[model samples]
Target: MYAIVEIAGQQFKVAKDQRVFVNRLASEEGQEVSFDNVLLIGDGDNVTLGAPAIDGAQVSAKVLKHLKGDKVIVFKKKRRKGYRVKNGHRQSLTEIVIEGITASGAKKAAPKKETKKADAPKAKKATGKADDLKKIEGAGPKAAEAMVNAGLDTFAKVADAKPEELSKILSEASSRLAHIVTETWPKQAKLAAEGKWDELKELQDRLDGGIEK
Candidate 1:
């Protein structure tokens, strides 16, 4: 069987035991990482597709190692303006081998629903642990995932994160996240960490979505 799955920010067609290189991920070497963004799965002539991503479908792989891709030169010039710039960049990448693919009805979060009655405790636990980054303005699912994967999963950590550092992380993850401005994220994260909900709300409103103007 083979499946098209998204890893980091790019998608690839992967099959069992196949080794693939992708943008660097935060998973440790030898650790198993699973992707739920299965676009389609195929086994022989039978094919299953998803509107965006298949529900309950997961692809798990073990990270083999991390390395750098071949360096490429970037050249830019402004004619008549006498402006010329040249640089070289090497992409960070990770090598992973597909372990298995679980098609339909193999939800990973299925066990978490058994204790539905413990929602109250879970809420408190969540509030004290790795906070939901989505609460911070300017952070959506993809952006938040990038942050969490980089180990800045808590409000306090995010509050202390420098804008330049955060920018580098986002840049390395995907060019799509390049447009996301994080100038005010630390300040907003600080308020959230301190439980200053009112102040955070005020700042987000004043900043007009908590993005740099």
Candidate 2:
């Protein structure tokens, strides 16, 4: 029998006693781990598939070891600009051997509910006209919402932001926003806050998705 399971945000097809290397897991070596996000289970000609993920299905494994993979070279350069950067990275990985596969009975743990004080009023959402931060090249709806939630609702506030600060906000917002290039956001926000549409247009024209050409 074989099963397709998700382990540490990556998927793998695994079977009994099969060893697999996956992204780093928090569990220590010799620890037992179980994944509840089983996608499919197959035995001979019979197969069971999940709607997104099968409820109560689980795959258990024992962590064998933790190690780093081969180094990867990262090189960047700007043509004729005398700009070059080189780096290397080795991926953290964990080795595990599948021990068992259960088609049911292993359920996800329920989150505990926090009880609030009876007299406490609910927190109010931020009010007032939110600036159109999406007007900035790299700022999508989610990114704009993140900035708003971080109390940066006005163009002036965004204009005063540092690239590192914006990067932190986006990183906390979502994984999708983590890769955004924030170098141009404050400059764009400054132009917009000052009502310099012609200048903003000219600058955006020279940019591609908030990145300098």
Per-model TM values vs. the true structure: 0.57, 0.56
User: Distance from true position, residue 97, model 1, in Å?
Assistant: 0.2
Count of clashing pairs, candidate 2: 0
Residue 168, candidate 1: C-alpha displacement in angstroms: 15
lDDT per residue as tens, model 1, 49-108: 988888889999999997778979889999999999986656667899999999976656
The alpha-carbon lDDT assigned to residue 202 of candidate 2 equals 87
Candidate 2 C-alpha error for residue 152, in Å: 17
Point out the worst 10-residue segment of candidate 2 by lDDT: 116-125
**Residue 53 displacement (Å), model 1:** 0.9
**Which residue pairs in model 1 clash with each other?**
none
Q: Give stretches of model 1 more than 4 Å off.
A: 109-213
